[model samples]
Target: ETVNGSEDIDTSMDMLQRQKYHHKRAFEYISQALKIDETQNSEQKEIAINLYQEGINELSRGINIDVWQGTGEKWIKAQRLHDKMQTNLAMAKDRLNFLATGKLSSRRPANLTIMNK
Candidate 1:
């Protein structure tokens, strides 16, 4: 029983460690994406959007596996980060679309007139 317990603990730790690695990588991708000017910087913007998509994919892969079985808090945090990455992915795609079309995907006005208060 003791040997089996040790193996279980080792397996659980390994899973948690992998999840942590995934979380860190996803955060990095989002950070890079945020630094890019997806609206104007055409060259870098494309790279940034691609990074965002990669981040979303990383999170998706991590979330697919069960993790943090012993610690509910860690599981919840990972889940939240995964959800946030999904939003980031959608926004990046929108930015990419806007960059290609010179207009927002939402179809907002292209020119904005400054109004005096």
Candidate 2:
């Protein structure tokens, strides 16, 4: 809501660039967190998990951000908007639900058991 030059920003390229920047940052955090194991009696792994969670939150912001697709061949952009919005919205909703409840949803099967003989 407060940034210099933001008042003049009104382009799909700008939106895509911002999205890419956020994605890059989130990926870095995720990669850093992925290299550590929390079960080794090390505090660093816990820190890493926290960092990864934070990165995921940031990634969600990027996914939720409004992006105005530029004027172009309307059909292509329309298809992209439909698919992209569905995927992004689903991810955001799934994360929010998971945060609220430990499980993803009741419909997800919970009775399946892996067995070895």
Per-residue lDDT over 45-77 for candidate 1, one digit per residue giving the tens place of the 0 to 100 score = 668768767777776666665753554565567
76-113, model 2: which lDDT tens digit per residue? 45446445545644554454355445475644445333
Candidate 2 deviant stretches above 4 angstroms: 1-10, 38-41, 68-117
Off by over 4 Å in 1: 1-4, 38-40, 68-117
Reference-based lDDT, each prediction: 0.65, 0.54
Clashes by residue pair, model 2: none
Worst 10 residues of 2 by lDDT: 108-117
